[model samples]
Target: MTGSSHFPVRGIIEGFYGLFYTAPERNDLISFIADHGFNLYIYGPKNDRQHRARWREPYPDFIMKQFAETVAHSMNRGIEFCYSIGSGVSINYASEEDFRLITSKYQAFYDIGVRHFMIMLDDIAAEFHHEEEQLMFNSYAGAHVYTANRLFHWLKSLDKSCKLSLCPTDYHGRAPFSDYIHELGKGLDQEIDIFYTGPEICSETISEQDTADFAAAVQRKPVIWDNYPVNDLAMKSEMHIGPITGRESSLPRVCKGFIVNTMSQAEASKIALLTFAEYFKNPDCYEPWPSWEKALKTIAGEESYESIKLFAENSLYSCLGYPEAALLDLLANKALFSLRSGEAASVSKDVQKLFDYLDSLDEAGYHLKYRMSNYALRNNLVPWIEIMESLAWAGRRAIAVLRALENNEDITAPLNWLKESVSEIRRHPKRYTGSILLPLIEYVESKVD
Candidate 1:
């Protein structure tokens, strides 16, 4: 089966740096992607020791069994399971022993009916680490091209149908591409696919021109490793639950395919993946917000859709740059503007509207925290949920402080509560609603002193 999309290849890559998914979670995700029209699943989580740090070592028996099971399930679902190896950290490119180890690792997977493979050289130093490699090759790209070519030929020898791809060290940025990228592109086997992220590691936008420029440099169309919802490294505190944005509809015509890098939170990552599915199926007609809404409704179900929607709205700030807490921000801005005018009627209407929105935020938090039936999603979202609740409560108290002082009543109680809630919210490192609530708190503080 070719899977479901206008784009020939569209799927997920378990390529994040943190804790990888469990076997059941991965299998479930394979099913999820298969159902959503994704045709490929690349297994290459950085934290998978055998796949990365200890690239020369074999997977443990239990782990190998899991791989076999996953490959079988993915095949049954019509999704290609592409096993990947990240050996750039310490592979001796000139060493025949190292080459043997690479083939030996892949041979095991090939034995189990796996046919697609990728040699990921991303996120590693470009300089030759081994003396033998330094002596044999003048540049980083030269060494990489030699090793990757050997592996591609080996995989083809084992089975002519086997496919190979590479994720180079200089995977992002615009042309004038680095000499390393240009040389690697020109020298590598014509059939071996190369992976490219857009202009940045986590690109905000990927235009058709961007891919066209990259393909011109690489001498072949690239397989995009689009990194959006993956919240690893610097973005660990973020919950990237927004829709896929910044990718032009015309991308399918220019590039070979797409492989989305997902977040460690498998359940939460589905929200964005669902939208990605919509894009892949009909890029020309895709609308991020509508697709996102549909995904929320499908994943959260009817009973909890509104609550999940409210919660999701606050956490939409990822690399895609969607507004954080958009509705709450609008209401708060209106309320603050009305307060500045010193109009009692305006303040009463606007501030109350802001307060009501905050109340809804709090209510959404409570519903997801206590009653949402999807336990895995709830668990994945607990950190952001708690932060949202705290921010909502704190915002409410800030408004209360303003009201009590406005009424010429004692402000000590509300003021103290406001301080405590803000403190509690700040204690957690995760972000919710961005800085939209800060001005209200600042305004309240300025008046009291």
Candidate 2:
């Protein structure tokens, strides 16, 4: 909790595009973040029409009640609940009526004790859509800064405690950014924080120098809107249960805050968020694997650790960059190397180790399917777990076929089973142990002729 060491804002934003979390889920996450020493939570899911598409409108009474409860619960847990609105999708920045509508929307939340807000102009066209906006402002950034600055002043007038953040259209890339962003940096209120998503929207690596360069361009320290472990849109097939990686420990020096964009599965997202909690706690000494193992133990619990670890290792590939199924890759490579060397003793030992790992992968899926106490996590992982089992089965069958050939035995049964397992794996789009599994199967198939 010391100011000198940790990020000013360390939290998760339930800001994915499709199928936002339910009220209960958000409440649970708020409590979870508080326990992990995180200090902020932003609500800005794109699918919530009232929060995005219908930004000018107030939330219905029932939904407003849920938001009130969520805000109250967050405050109770010592977490700041930042209500975010995606207004750029259809905002008429020049219209006084539109400005009033946007402020009125925040006024409702303010009444419910919300003092933190974000005006999101992301994922929208940079060009002005309205005639009035085009005539009033020279560029996209000009219109956005005009609205944001006005909002900041009005919010300050209502309450000096009000905190506002603005997400610029050109929110990512190496600096100096687009003219829009440079203009945003110069024109936007300095008191208001700007959101920047590293070198790319879904950046693989966020270096210290890159962040410093961006801060220089923005004319203020930017709050990192880190997009990781968020499997939505085109990435619907992924299950990102891996650790946080590629972010420099020196990031806190250049950035104002750090916030993760989470996946649709609330419980599963906690696995990655827990690692994020560790990183933000003491970024200087954070090690991805150790932090990841600790996160698995803390969130998944001891009973399901091995199973969840195996599952997580296979599901690690995302935009954040990780070697998928690292353990399996190691063992498979060792076995393949031994096989190539024609060392019978080494081959027997290494190949058996690989086979054992594959066996465990299959067993882990089966055990988690029926035995995992966390039903929500289990449900979220079902698709990937099934694929894990399929890949394991395929690996085992491939090994069996290879062994049978070595012994001069008929490969019919094992070969047929291998084909069946591969077929099962390919039927679904879910990925686990992705690149390694297919090449191993192809290598075994190469042995057949």
What local lDDT does model 1 show for residue 279? Answer: 87
Runs of candidate 2 with Cα error greater than 4 angstroms are: 1-5, 337-347, 404-413, 447-449
Best by lDDT: 1
Candidate 2: pairs in clash:
none
* Alpha-carbon RMSD of each model: 1.8, 2.2
Give one digit per residue, the lDDT tens place, for model 1 in 1-449.
12234578787899999999999999999999888888899999999899999999999988889889989999999989999999888888899998999899999999887999999999998777678787999888888888999899899888999999999999999979899889998999999999989999999999999899999899999989999899999999999999999999889777888999999999999999999988887888889999999999888888999999999988888899878778888998988888877844225798898889889989998999899998899999999999898888888898888878777889899899999989988798898888898898888888889
The superposed Cα distance between candidate 2 and the true structure at residue 97, in angstroms, equals: 2.4
Q: Per-residue lDDT for 1-449 in model 2, tens only? A: 45336688787888898999989999998999898878999999999998999888788999999999999999999999999999889888889998898899999999999999999999998787789887888888888888999999999999999999988888899966787777888998899998888888889999888888888887999989999988889888888888889999889889987889999999998988888887887887788889889888777778999999888877888887777778889988888777767744225898899899989988999978999888888888898888888888998898899888888889999999999998998897887777786666787888897
Q: lDDT of each structure? A: 0.89, 0.87
